[model samples]
Target chain A: MGGDFGPQVTVPASVQALLQYPELKVILFGDQSAITSQLSLLNQLQHPRLSIVHCEHVIANETRPSQALRSSQGTSMRMALDSVSDGQADACVSAGNTGALMALSRYTLKQLPGVDRPALVTAIPTNTDNKTWLLDLGANVSCDADTLFQFAVMGAVLAEQENSASPRVALLNIGEEEIKGNDLVKRCAEMLANSPDINYIGYLEGNELYSGRADVIVCDGFVGNVSLKTSEGVANLFIDSIKNAISTNPLKRLVAKWLFNDLFISLKQLNPDQYNGASLLGLRGIVVKSHGSADVAAFSNAIGEAVHEVKRQIPTKISDRLEEVLLERHY
Target chain B: MGGDFGPQVTVPASVQALLQYPELKVILFGDQSAITSQLSLLNQLQHPRLSIVHCEHVIANETRPSQALRSSQGTSMRMALDSVSDGQADACVSAGNTGALMALSRYTLKQLPGVDRPALVTAIPTNTDNKTWLLDLGANVSCDADTLFQFAVMGAVLAEQENSASPRVALLNIGEEEIKGNDLVKRCAEMLANSPDINYIGYLEGNELYSGRADVIVCDGFVGNVSLKTSEGVANLFIDSIKNAISTNPLKRLVAKWLFNDLFISLKQLNPDQYNGASLLGLRGIVVKSHGSADVAAFSNAIGEAVHEVKRQIPTKISDRLEEVLLERHY
Candidate 1:
């Protein structure tokens, strides 16, 4: 979560995590004064597990992640990931900058064997009891047949770890037809249909993904990012639209008050914060990327997700499965 | 509006249009029996201005629009555009296939001067008093800087025709900053920022398009399509989530009933049918494309839009402006 706002959000979230789970340990990494000030605001002066790693300077807006990482050896996010890579920290979570996080994690941890491009995987609540996992939401925009196939395998393994025993995978396409969508979707479908490592359920339209037809959906980063943002925009638009409509008229206002709680709960369930962090699948170590705008609740959820990924050893299992599938396909 | 599920949706909508406005005239272009059968289902069938143009066949699903135009001579959609080109009809509306509509219109009507690609412009209802116009939602996915500039001009012209005077146009990008987005958006910003033809207000993020920041929002078909679909998906998800949350408990159910009208009105405002048809901007004649799943309301709206476009002489005005701009740009 290489976040733009930095320690302000992360520090409070760290304290909240400790309050929720007594055993939970959090390390605050950022500008020392900024982290201490945020924690002080929360009345968390000091704790056994909570500690701060001081980094006087910060990455500027114009500095690329590689440039920042190479120049600043002890940046907050970098140090956190380094902890994970060196076995000091089980997993690392950030709600900062996405590109920075991806670059740092990939460079430091290295890509998993047989995985060409790592994908950003996030869960979206669906109509069904089970949540649907969408991948490459903004990781790799352009993907080949092999990259897409590997994404499906990795996504399936991640879903299984999340709870699904045999998660069904579907390629995001314009239409359900085997021949529909751009060249990439078409090629990916052909590969997924033949791949034996994952339970590929065939093609799914953008609309059907939320309709709860499949558990795991995969696409190139360009389409995925657009889809994800589109979803978020629509959700915000609806809520705002409803709120405006309700406040407009007297009769509607009365109705709105009665139905407010129901709507609130329903909207809460769909909140991006509830499904806040995206796992950087195909990385050697567990790296959960939270949204830059994530609040305390969202950050806590992301930290919990990071903890789960480490405890389950999901990366190792996914890598082993990916290698077997790649070898079989190659031979 | 050449749609796969034509005649059934369009015929009723055509009748509804006539019923809504007694002065309106409708000419259905499709299989005669299919049109007649639908008309027979309506109570007031006999009208002096209502007529039909018989076409024997339609473009099949597998046929690309360009391929269909080259091979299928008697397709209904192509024939409808021919009616406009030949002055038999003032404008054409279809709930038929989109690709076929694009291909036939581009071939028959040709492009307005200076317009490289004819964009599909759709209106989305926002919280503000005016509806937001989103262009090239699914017309041309891959476009260059020049094409985007043309799209902005066409979109702005269409918006003005639709009663938006001095319609502000904004290039949709990943971020609002001029430097944000990919190469296409960046170059488009430079062109749009300096272009005398458009009232360019700079870049708008995908999320802020609904905030009423700009009247006309422009993007390539790929991004536009995803944005439109994503908005639809999120809106649907929000409604579903709210409904589920409300019904989960009795207390919430009471609140939901009170807020039902507010929610319904707001959701209805966001409904695609309200802003159903997308004008194929830059075409020689007025051509409106409705969604394939368009019901009676959407089709009727498309017909209404066609009538409005014809009355406003949008195509002619856009062509005149584009010609002027093209000459100035030395294109």
Candidate 2:
């Protein structure tokens, strides 16, 4: 049962992430009578950290990520990526079908050793005291220069696990001129300007991807999904041209409902449902994904980004910092 | 001579496009004593439809478009592309060095015979009912699929001269899938889905490039200059985060100046200085470019888009509809 309000928005966003994580556990995987009739209209259907597991096949938001990674095996998005590849789920969230949740989360949890393919990462909201991250947001729609130097070292170790001591890094490029792009973004900005243990920074255009001057940008998943869906289509054409210019002046809709309730309370601090999840970075366990038109508060912020990448064991910290920066560039 | 407000914003934007075109005539071409000392500080220093032409070999916004078309021969952006290739200028606006004005306007007015290289177009504002041309906004940075089927027949003959009766066209693709991109955008969306003489409209994503539903759009030139500088860096981060959340409340900046005055008058109708010029399309004379940090009313709307593509002759309607669609595809 993939997105577009699937179990009426993933069963009340998995019973509100099992009532905000008191050691959360949800195992839903799909259509056991349409997720138990949306978890029997949610009075937390007998909720001892919830459970469902019935999944009799579903996956089609027009399937085809190489034919749903070889025929979506018993699909509730491949049994929620086979319950996080069988070790009884540390993390798995979907909203589903972003190319069948990135080809069944890279064919049921694979890729982590000094990672070669898994990239899609996200997070952009910027003015800065943290939030830039980007990556191969569409997952390898033609990358190179060593998979954009391993998507700038897994977007600088996921922005240095947000504690951010020295993040920066860049390379989305179309001019910050080392003779601007092509020839594979000038050989991925000459391998992030000769690595030097990666605080790189040489280039970043597409209008400085939310100008929080780089805490890992990188590109190549079709220019990071066209610079993250052209900044969500210019913030949905500036909130539909300010609600069609305040519904054409019935005294500017009574002063635009106190100016769109003080601009949607500071645009709910740049909310795409409070930045719903994306991760799928160099994979080997955690899956995240979300936005297949996510709702119920953006699939409970993609189950609070798979419980913050399973309490920060973000795939053993990107497989121990991509095996110590690929054995110190012995690549 | 070339942007960053050269001659204090192109000599008061060529004296406000010769006071809004009474058959306008300009010709200043740089350093005629820093443009007659900025038209002797704009007291209209002898402005009989203006003329200056002093040119002292300049071109240096970090040169190299093959060394600025071989030593920027007689500079002022090469005598304004040799005064539109000797027809003494019907069109040629510049904000300098867009790869040295597409290599001296393709080494002086060349291409346009079933054109090969020269796309960098513009015009984006779109909630439709106009605006959305796009193109190789950075000029040929790795294109192929027959240069994106000749940028979808020169962006559907410049969106059918912006009247757009049958324009729709498309291609930009990072997924509005027909097997989403790469493989040169699926062999240029199978030559605009078997051509029927252009109105293509298949793949579109990058959030439907301002969801004003495709009136041409095309791609390449590094994903059309990262989808036109990521929609000018998401309209400069939504006008610097709604002016830092309406300046942290002194009664919310006196109720955010009457609710940001009808959302900045419908965001000044999606202004980037009212879409300041760009059009370098399949050459044969008509240049445009602007915005190297444009400012005198956005270089008088890039000299009113080079007097609206020299009064819409637009290189005799794109060399007679690209020589009747390249002789009805006999290429």
Query: Could you give the fnat of all candidates in order?
Result: 0.40, 0.56
- For model 1, chain A alone compared with the true chain A gives a TM-score of 0.93
Give a tens-digit lDDT track for model 1, residues B110-194. Answer: 9877778898889887667777788777667568898888888887887786546788999876531212467777788888777
Between which residue pairs do clashes occur in model 2? none
* Candidate 2 TM-score, true structure as reference: 0.37
Q: What would the per-residue lDDT of candidate 2 be over residues B75-178, giving only the tens digit for each residue?
A: 88888888889998788888877887888888888888777887878878888678788888777778788877877787777777775658888877786242
RMSD (Å) per prediction = 3.4, 21.7
lDDT score of model 2? 0.78
Off by over 4 Å in 1: A1-8, A19-23, A33-46, A60-67, A141-145, A175-179, A248-258, B1-9, B19-23, B31-34, B37-43, B58-67, B70-75, B163-165, B175-179, B245-258
DockQ measured for candidate 1: 0.38
lDDT (10s digit) by residue, model 1, range A178-264: 124666777888888877777889877766768778889988776777677656666677777777767778876785666675567
Candidate 2 lDDT over A89-190, as tens digits, reads 887888777876877788788888867788888787776677888888777888778878887887787788783866888877776242377888777777
Error of 2 at A194 (Å): 20
DockQ of each: 0.38, 0.21
